[model samples]
Target: MDKHLIDDIKHVSLSLFNKNFFGVYHGSISARVSASGFIINSKDTILDEVTEESLVRLDCQKRDYRWSMANADVHIHEHIYET
Candidate 1:
């Protein structure tokens, strides 16, 4: 992913957290990276303190569970990407 994009996600996540839009370990953020792939925040990640390491890449075409940091709402993000 591009450094600027990643930074933007982090900034937004932090802003949302700071504004009480998403509490600690509550909400999630995601960005479509390709036609069949995207990056989403990990489960239990504090939105106020999001880091690059807190993001997980997922393949929308396949139902793979190999990622340890994948968020619980990953399916939702995938569905959005599909549309």
Candidate 2:
């Protein structure tokens, strides 16, 4: 994982948190990490307080038990990143 990428996400999370957006909804935040892979917040992550463990890296649409920690919105993020 890239340190700068994680920092960028954390920065955005704080900015968005003040807007009462993500902080209120507790929604997932994501960033594309590769052509077919992206990192997103885990299902229960607090956006404003994201840590490395709070992020989940997904490279495929297929889900396994390992993906249980991924966000429920992972598919939505994947679709957006696809294009």
Candidate 3:
């Protein structure tokens, strides 16, 4: 929901993709957006072109329908943030 955060994530995603640090579909990026949650790229997103809609905002403590588009590794991310 934060444009600045979204742009920051986009920049990193592109940089990693350009540097070969990320393959066609091999990497994902996330950052804490709030004390209780974080934002991450949805599954199937092109790392270099992730738009706001391709991002999922998740609560560190719970899952919801909005989680459908999140990567399968989302649970791991959530757990990391929770702790």
Per-residue lDDT of candidate 1, residues 1-83 (tens digit): 67887899999998888899898888889998888888999896888887888888888777666355688777777789984
Model 1 TM-score? Answer: 0.88
lDDT on C-alpha atoms for all candidate structures: 0.83, 0.82, 0.85
Residue pairs that clash (backbone atoms under 3 angstroms), model 1: none
TM-score for all models, in order of appearance: 0.88, 0.86, 0.89
Give the per-residue lDDT of model 3 (tens digit) for 1-83.
98898888889889999999887777888999888798888888888898998889998777688788887678778877884
In candidate 2, the residue pairs with backbone N, CA or C atoms under 3 Å apart (3 or more residues apart, or in different chains) clash, namely none
In model 3, which runs have C-alpha deviations exceeding 4 angstroms? none
Worst lDDT run of 10 residues, candidate 3, spans 74-83
The runs of at least 3 residues in candidate 1 whose Cα sits more than 4 Å from the true structure, single-residue gaps closed, are none
RMSD of 2: 1.8
Query: Which numbered prediction scores highest in TM-score against the true structure?
Result: 3
- Of the two candidates 1 and 2, the one with more favorable lDDT, higher being better, is 1
